[model samples]
Target: MFGLGAYRRWLRSDRVRLGRWGERRARAFLRRRGYRIIARNWRCPAGEVDLVAADPSGPIAFVEVKTRRDEHWAPGQQAVHERKQQHLARVAQWFARRYGLKDRSLRFDVIVVVVPETGRVEVRHYPSAFRPPC
Candidate 1:
């Protein structure tokens, strides 16, 4: 039946599916760059870190992946504004404390992906993308 409930559910699921797909692509890109995958979709009450990876030598990265279809009005990286960065920083702090990684350096990264219905998927990686007040 064409009801609001079904529509809402569909919207939620669609978003989830898209997020997962983007995360998957982001993970691959990080791996190719020699980042060891530490966690995916690490979440806390404050927010979620799409990907947590360890750099080659030291320090950890908290990645945010934004994927959009072709012709997005704005670049994906811009979505992680000051407020969003703060939330993710809080989440990263919680994750570090919880995982005994407080002693290590941490950085915020962003991966912007453009997945067209047909053709190559464009990915842009911005390491040290933002400064978080952690």
Candidate 2:
């Protein structure tokens, strides 16, 4: 039997490995879709956006990525609660203002990452997932 400390360490390591794997899957999916990745793991006082990308149309997108091993509890997109949405909007606004992108078009997106036990990853991208604050 594993001691408490050993179990905790195992859990932490597992989480870290899962996170990195999810991020890699997200990047690969985006690249295959022809979207140019501008940033990853962008953080601010408000919140963090997992990925930011731009298309040929000049619209900048802020993406929220949720990864899960199973869809038993809820779908990955459903994980973005109301509070999380608000934080994402705030952070996106800050990003726009800081970069003087006010006049440019912007959008919010969500990417759901589902990793099966076989290690295959499925990513679903939802464009314009939410509206920015007025």
Candidate 3:
């Protein structure tokens, strides 16, 4: 019974809610694996990063979280394409400069969360998934 605009808005809000839930799950998963969460939903002029965490013995991680339902066609991580990587790289640089972490090692990570309406939730982590262009 909803109009086109209303349906689009509802879908967008639903996606946002799902994304936030996935981020929370990803945070818990990372904490269980000994990664210290530094920030959530960090945003700047370049773009936004879903989560930023520090590995116990490795580089700081700029995590991109992709959340989906079912994911029968394509995995959520696939959504983080080249252009998105470049965008995150820029945001990471800005974050590092602002936080005085320029000299420290940095890494890009992708966390794919699949939440099925009638099945168990799934999470896949990809560490150092991509490198920024020089």
Candidate 4:
């Protein structure tokens, strides 16, 4: 059996590395899909937005990217629950207002990246994934 320290380190470092790698893949995927990247890891007191971007002549997209070693843990899209969506909405609104985009169209998107232990990467994008809670 392993000690608690090793287990904790695994949780923190390995997972974070995987996540950061996924974010890079997400950015590349977004670029290939023709989304103009505005900001990444955008943060404020309220929360953090993974990516802020825009479609070609379209709405501003507030994107959340989820990365996992595999789908066995859980579907990445399922992780964005109501609470998470609400948090994203709050952050998206803050970004929009700050950037003078309040009058422009807005949307929430989800991008799921799955990296296996030693296999190909999978990326799925869900545009207009959620709407801000009323």
The candidate scoring highest on lDDT is 3
TM values, all candidates: 0.88, 0.86, 0.95, 0.93
lDDT of 4 by residue, 1-134 (tens): 87999899988998889888989999999999898999999998889999998888689888899998888968999899999999998898789878999789999999999988888889999999887777
lDDT of 2 by residue, 35-72 (tens): 89988988888778888888667799888888788888
Error of 3 at 24 (Å): 0.5
- lDDT at 105 for candidate 4? 95
Q: What is the C-alpha RMSD of each candidate to the true structure, in Å?
A: 1.8, 2.0, 1.1, 1.5
Q: Rank the candidates by TM-score, best first.
A: 3, 4, 1, 2
**Tens digit of per-residue lDDT, candidate 1, span 87-109:** 99999989989999978999999
Quote the lDDT for 48 in model 2.
Answer: 80
On the 0 to 100 scale, the lDDT of residue 102 in model 4 is 70
Backbone clash count for every predicted candidate, in the order shown: 0, 0, 0, 0
**Best-performing candidate as measured by TM-score:** 3
In model 1, where do residues sit more than 4 Å from their true spots? Answer: none
* lDDT order of candidates, top first: 3, 4, 1, 2
Please, what is the whole-model Cα lDDT of each candidate in the order they appear? 0.89, 0.83, 0.93, 0.90
Q: What's model 3's TM-score?
A: 0.95
- Residue-level error in angstroms, candidate 4, position 22: 0.3
Query: For candidate 3, which ten residues in a row score worst on lDDT?
Result: 70-79
